[model samples]
Target chain A: MKVLSRLLQIREASILLFIFLFVGCIGIVNPAFTSGDSLGLILKSSMILLVLAVGQSFVLLTANIDVSVGSTMGLSAAVCGILLSHGVSGYLAVGAALVIGLCIGAANGLGVSFFRIPSIIMTLGTLGIVRGYMLFYTEGRWIEDIPHYFKELSAAAFLGIQLPVWIGGIAAVLAFIFLSRFSVGRYFYAVGDNEAGARLIGLPVRFITVLAFTFSGLSASIAACLFVMNIGFVPNQTGSGIELQVIAAAVLGGVSLSGGQGSLFGAALGAIFLEVINHSLVFLKVPAYWNNAISGFLLLLIVTGDSRFQLWLKGNGKKKKQEQEDMNRSKLPKSGEDGYEDKVVL
Target chain B: MKIKWFYRWEFFLLLLFIVEIAIFGWISPGFLHVNNLLFSMNDFMFISIAAIPMTLVIISGGIDVSIGSIMGLCSIILGVSWSHGVNVWLAVIIAIFCGLAAGLFNGLIILYSRVQPLVVTLGSMFLFSGLALVISGGSKASGYEGISGFPDAFVQLGNGSFLGVPNPVWFLFVMTAAFCTLLHFMKYGRSVYLVGINSKAALYSGLRIKWISLSTYILSGLGGGLSGILLTSYFSSARADLGSEAVLPVITAVVLGGTSIIGGRGSIAGTVLASIVIGFMQYGLQAIGLTSEQASIVIGAMLILSVMARQSSFQKVMQWFRQRKSNSSDLMY
Candidate 1:
């Protein structure tokens, strides 16, 4: 009971509660929504986003952003897809994709950390460049010749769920543990929470930032692998606009974009929540066009409400402290009161 | 580091513009035609229009990524209203007001919530774009086809010209002048700079920092709305995806115009000139037979190179390299 209460006390617990309520409402409207098959499908569909959101959460933890994640995903997927089509071994193709992702991420990290360029601008520059390069390399054409074995990887189930889902779930769990229980993982929070303090305390702040982005890029590559396998093809616009969605998912999951807050589980849950919203829109028969608007509106609503709630909690704490101070004053001796009166008068 | 006369960015941009025209004209003589040069402004006037207000947003220490989607939303709003038999002019006004409300929403949420402007605007960007799609999908004109056949007066707003210049060019000039006056010749402009430089100091000095920051967002939304209308007029169609690809170039123009992304250091004149430079660069790229995707690579590179060149650290590094080279030469002597 104590453990349960402690879990409920977390900021993400509210989000978890909201998700349950939301799913319950949807289930009430459409019984199919609660079905194991549908729920599984939602989880499967959100796996890519879950991974991306986790990666994005790391960057957010470091108070930096990588808008190029989507483009990197597309480019890496393109490379993997093209290499696979050319009969390259799966390991080589996947390795190339991950390396490409790491290089792009390293470039973004170097520009922001070493060159002193703003993260947004540097990543935006990479977004354009990577996207353009992918388009050019693909000759503005889609790759639809993915091998059957590659596509089968997404189909292969472990414990009644797809391989990718299990991979994503395990990745999220590992990341959560890594970010929470590990000393190196804690450095991300320290760096973002107080860069100057971290530096003064002998932390390699720049290297940590670069590591955060590299992790983001690596995760994006993993997402790309899953994306290509599931779709069995790669389009030039494979990950266009997914950056916003991934960031939204991370921010929605209680990851503060301003840095030094949030967790991987929250981001995974946020990704699931977003997928549920998308899935439920179809189930509820709302026009598909309303999906983006609804998701965005809900994101705004939740963020605003969450911040207000924090502010209220803070105010409540201050008031409690003030009342305690008053009570202590009332219990003070008369001579101490005379000293306080003299100080006030002075 | 002292900047040489040749290193004055705005002046250099002007020179670059002239050189661009000369080179493009030499490659394709028809590119130099007065009508071609003037009318080409129509293609990117929306970027110029949007960048003008963006200059202020960046100057006020905030960013609005939603203007692109807001542009699309406002355009769809005007189109949907007009398609429903409302007067075109009235629909335009309604659309502009909607932009104002969106901006107000952004400003209010950012101020009270104390969330980073980047994250707030990022969310709003998605919201506005999604709203645009919803509005369009609900309207009679659905799917890939856009609403068209606007009244002549409304169409004239985008295409009509006076003194042999396109209406968009005129609109761009007028808006630039108005924003320039508001930013350079007014106290409100000073407050914006002060707030950006140090919000706490500005607050202590009796400035309504919130209002000034909020007003910049409102102005940005106004620009987005106006650009949407102009785009619809120019193309004679209104689509939900109008200006969807605009955020990058608009920001690039502002940043290239010498506006510090970190805020408090920028100029209206710089933004205007930078917009023209970028607009012409795109046109000239296509004129030289490069694809738009290819052109974007150049634009992206330009954005990074320009900003990096402007960094104080970059200058220090360059000075260090030069000093090292001189020291080596002295050893040789």
Candidate 2:
């Protein structure tokens, strides 16, 4: 029971357990779903979302959002696909896509940090512009018959894991390290957790904030490359609506939209959970249409449950001190000797 | 200097609107006719409808992305129920109820959990649209094949006109008046502004913050419901994707109308006028042989430019006016 409570306390643990139970239930309904090979298929399919979520975690950690990511991926993949189809070398194609991502991400960062535009509107405008640019550049044409080498690279397996899976793993691992290791890494949480305090402490809050956006762009571009490689084609609607998926994954992994909480591993786990749910919909022979509703429902349940659990643990059941907490949250700390700073010492 | 006229939002927007009409008429001689203009005006009002309530929501320091999903869900409910032998009016009412429930759920969650409104609404955006799909019998019955065979009275509600004005345009006018009055003239209006400007202060001032917040969302839901029903009538069918394209335009209208995204300051009048401007601009661009997708690019540019204009300080403009005045005086000397 102690272990059970411990498992429940960590969002990642609970999400993992939930994923397995869901899969297991579907297996009961259809025995073939629990097979080892199908489980590998699930992991393989989740790789793109996992990579995107890892990137999104960096921005969410800084209390900002990048809604332009979906279009960024689309644009980058289009550019790369066009370039590769033109017989450009693979390295050059990759370099060009990364450059495009950097410029766009830098623009997003500057718009939010310098112009003081809200991140959502800034990125939303960018989302439209980037997608428009892609359409115009590609002339709304699909780039098919991508080079055979590129397709093979994406599909090639190592130690039973596909290339995209390995890339996603490296990304997750790298995100965890970058967020946990460097001193600047810790600044993201500080700035996001308490911006004014971080400023008062003489941190390069602007630099860190800009860096998060850049990292988000870089991650999305990487995902774009994987996308182009995996599917070996670039359609007009490529990467459409991916921002919501990446965001949902990050949120499911316990990353607070308010920022300063959650881990990349939890986000990766969330990607897996979402992907598995998608897979289970097939296994259960649920109408092909109910897939979206189920995931959306699960997204609500998890977030709502997590919040209620936090409130319950705080011993302030519904109604009691609710207004008091509101007042406290809105108010600034009275002086320098604040205890809230110590709470994030990890 | 006549620069003072520019400082009045209504005067500025009205002047701009007139100038815009003249310019469009100049560009396309066919644009000046009333029948042509009013015909297109029918499709434009629902955008105004959604933006009207959204103005109140933004003025209260929150947003409702889920309104789009609410519209979709309501449309689906009306369609599915009507196809199953229900009276169209009754089905519309049921659709409105679903909107209210969805909106109420959003308010309750945000109120109890104290989460950010954007994330909450974003989550529900997906949830409601997905539910709409399920109710429409999933992909098997979906993919642009909307439910049809509506009663003639309901069809007239979408198509018929009053005194040469489109019914949708009339609905827009009435809703705008009602909401503008509620937002600008009533005591509740003051509470909404007070809550948005400083929520903590509002709470301490004996205002019911919970109820006020909840009311904004409920009212926004009703706005979405009204638009959904109109959309069903307009097309004489209903689908799960109703109002999906309206999210960005609604947000754009609210912000471009001089509403601060951070909340506290907004005007219903500005939002209505801005929606008109945007709706016309979309039509105008398409009239010039630009595809709707290309026109979307232009609108996207307008959205960013409007927000950037609002974010910049008016001090610069004021300084320019002062400098011009001083230079004129020096020339007089």
Candidate 3:
């Protein structure tokens, strides 16, 4: 019963458990799916998504979203690629990417904070605008000729793990500490939980909101650097259709669409889970096109289950409240002592 | 009269429309030619036609991002039906029904499941796109090759002009007028506005908020279907990717026209004028040295700048400057 209660408490964790069990079942059916190289490749591929999800978790915690992260990554990578091709040092190229990403993020923050536009609409608009800028800047051409050192940073391994996996691990650790141990992190939850309450308490809501987006931007720049290093070429379709994947990862990780909940650890694990499932499908000889259908099916199942679980929780909360009310009623005296008892109860 | 003047975003749109024509006419010598002007209007007709119901949907406190995919799906269905030797008119009706069905799915999930409209529409956007790709087998359908013998009357709907103006433009004008009249003059229209402003309040007042939202989505679906049919006829080809790029442009037209994204306050007249403004801007910029891709930068900048100009921060800054100047003058005195 305790285990059941605990399972109910962490519904997303249970979902993750079910996913792993399913993956394990698949592995038992196809032993080849458990190979080291396959696992390594999946983790490496998930690194960018992991980074993106972490960044998005911050924004979502503040009741905002960064739908343009994918495009911003593409644009940043394109910037990096352009500079590196022109003989800029790798560090300098990365710095430039971060600065450009910061500018874009600042623009999104300003739009939402000052313009009073909803984050969803603002980000959606920038998704196109940023992608358009990237296209115009690169003239729809692929950026080839990335330096070998940068490529190694993306693909190379340490202690039998790829660099990106290690980077993702470090990022997750840092994010966990920052969110759990810091006052600023508590402020984010406060703001997302009840904006009017936070404002009444005198929290710097706008600055924190902007800071969340800046973190999102910085993370996207990092992901872009990792992405360009891995692919060695930046195409116009580099991050095409990635917004869905980022949102899916965050949602599957237990991030509430309405905001104020979720963890970076859950987001990373969700990214890993998604990437592994994708790899497993390929390993199991599923057709590439069927992947979308499968993911869509899984997404539907997960979201419906989550929503049902939420409904159950709400019902339980209501029942508990009603029970408490009944208990209070039963303890009350009949008519004559009502006034004295009411005063005592109050 | 004073109340009307104060509430005249639509009138402002008209003034901008006149200014656009004058500016474009002066910039490009050929802009004044009747044929060029007619052709430009024709080029913009499809987007404007599609923006009609979208305007209503936005004002009804919901959004439909899947219109582009619905348009593509409808076009594909129309082409497939035509290729199967069905009558063109019946095929068009079937295509419109397909669009309606897709939109119904969106409305049901959003209303019944209590999902956020943004998330639901985002999911449906991909769902419809995937469905289109799967049904079409990821290939373009050149039904013009097989249906080359379209009836002259059907062809004239796309190609022929009336009274020296293109038929497409006339269709757009009629549809816009009809929608404007419906949105402004009808009780249902007022209900839509009230619902958008406050759903709970509307419900308290005995309005069917869900039905209002659902019907607007259906209307958007129909609008998308009409745009698809027109586009398939105009380009004489149908593909799964036909209207994919129209999503951003249509939303931009709606938002740039000064319609509140949060819903309740907007004007179809504003949307019409905004479409014209965007159309002229695109054409005029293209007429200059800017490539189509570069023109996106300008459009993007304008969107950001317009929103920024509406910020309270700007107003605060202006007030601060005024206060500072006044204080300094008093000290000097």
Candidate 4:
């Protein structure tokens, strides 16, 4: 019962419950949505976002944001796609893309941590610079004609599930283990919870911040690779506006924007939930144009509801603790009298 | 004479402006013409207008990314109402009210929900833009088929000159003066800075933190609304995506003008000067045949570089370089 209560108290449990309720409601509205095929499609479509959200959760865990992730994804995919079209080796192109992503991420981290620029502003600047440069480099054109073998990688199935889903799932599981079980990984939480206290405790706060961003960039690159494979081409506008979705996904998964709270699993689930919403809208025959507005409304509603629920829980806990204290005080006098009566009888 | 004007960031910005003008003039002689300078103000007028309130928002330690979308929404509102036979002027007023309401929504959500301003504004950004698209009928045709054919007077409001200066230049000056007085000379302005510097302390000391923060967002919304209306008139068309591209440059202007994103330190003068510098830079770059995308790369780099240059760490690194130079000279001697 205690374990069950503790599990129920976790933010991930609530997110899971919300997802189940949402899926059930959608299923009731359109029975087709509940089918194994449609559900699998939803998970497949969410793989890229799931990968990006896990990376984002790292920076969020450290109380910093990386708005450049979307652009990073775009630039890397552009490079990777262009390379493949030019008949370059697949592994080489992928490595180059990863390196580019890492460098951009490191630059963001350096600007925010070393130069002391605000992470949001720093990343915003990079977002523009990177996007603009990519456009300029490509001359505002798309990179098409990617190699066939590379494109086939996304569709290849493993154990009856698609490759992208397996990759996203593995990334989330690995990140969950690293974050929860590793001592060094705990530094991100500590730094985010209280920077001054973390520094006072002799933690490398700046380095940890940089590491988190680097990991975020690395993940964006991985997502970019998947994007190239899945889409088979890179548009100049690749990953544009996707930062909003990734951030929304992380936040929906109960990752506090203020930082120091959330998990990789929750973020991944949030990604899947967002994808499901997108697909469900189609299944429900909603206009495609309404997607943006509906998603925005849902984000606001969920966040407001979650915050209100947290406040109520806090208030209830305080009241319960007060009652417990009052009960203890009343029982203390009776216990004292019983001890005295026992002594007299003796 | 007692003031060390050289030490101020605004002074540095002025110097940068002079340097930019000299360089641009050398590259394109026509760029130095007064008429050209005033005419080019039309290109970035919306950005400057929005940056004015954005200055206040940043000074209060909050950000409103939704302002750009608010501009779009207000523009659509003005267009739809005017087409529906309402007086164009009344439509503008109604549009401004919509902007205010959107801002109020943002302020209330951030205040009551205790969510970070960034997240709340991000959500609203999409919401406002989506509404704009919806109200405009979500047609790809709307790209070029936006509402047009406004009355001559309304069109003249955006393009006409007064006293040999463009109307936009005048608007910029007036708005700058009004906000300058509000930010630098008013008691309410002091409370904004106080709240931004330390909200907890400000609250304990009897400051109305909520009102101060909320008012900044309202003003920002008003600025967005005004930007949308002017943009509509300038182009003689109203589209759902009118100021969608303004967010980057507007923020660059405010941050470049020395408004710390962390809040509690900024100036209106700096923002105006910085916007002018940036506006001219873009104009000059385009005059020299650079694409808009290339210009964006320059602006983005400039934003990051300027901020990095302002950091104490950068200064320390410079000092260390100087020391190394001096120490190496001594060893050689």
Model 4, B27-69: lDDT tens per residue? 8787888888888888888889999999998888888889889
Best-fitting candidate, measured by lDDT?
1
lDDT head-to-head 3 vs 4, winner: 4
Interface RMSD of 4: 15.9
Give per-residue CA lDDT, model 2, range A57-114, as digits (tens): 8888888888888889999999999999999999999899999888888888888888
lDDT of 1 by residue, B267-303 (tens): 9888889899888888998888777776777777777
Error of 3 at B129 (Å): 0.9
Residues A89-194, candidate 1: write the lDDT tens digits: 8889999999999998888888877877888788888888888888888998999998899999988997787999998998888888899999999999998888
DockQ of every predicted complex: 0.33, 0.36, 0.17, 0.27
Considering every candidate listed, which one attains the maximal DockQ? 2
Model 2 DockQ (Cα-based): 0.36
Tens digits of per-residue lDDT, candidate 3, A117-152, equal 777667767876788789888988899988778887
DockQ-derived CAPRI band for the predicted complex in model 2: acceptable
Tens digit of per-residue lDDT, candidate 4, span A223-312? 999999899999988998899889989988888776788888889888888888788899999877677677778778877777767766
Q: Candidate 3, overall lDDT?
A: 0.76
Off by over 4 Å in 3: A2-6, A9-11, A21-31, A273-286, A291-294, A316-346, B138-156, B311-333
lDDT by residue (tens digit), candidate 2, B1-333: 566767756555676678878888999999989898887878777888989988888888888888888888899889988887888889989988988888888888777655567757777888888888888874335655799878899998989988998899999889989998899999999899987787767767778877998999998888888899999999998999989878877888887787777678889989988888888888887888876656667677676766665566554666677889899999999
Q: Against the hidden reference, what TM-scores do the models get?
A: 0.91, 0.90, 0.86, 0.91
What docking class should model 4 receive?
acceptable
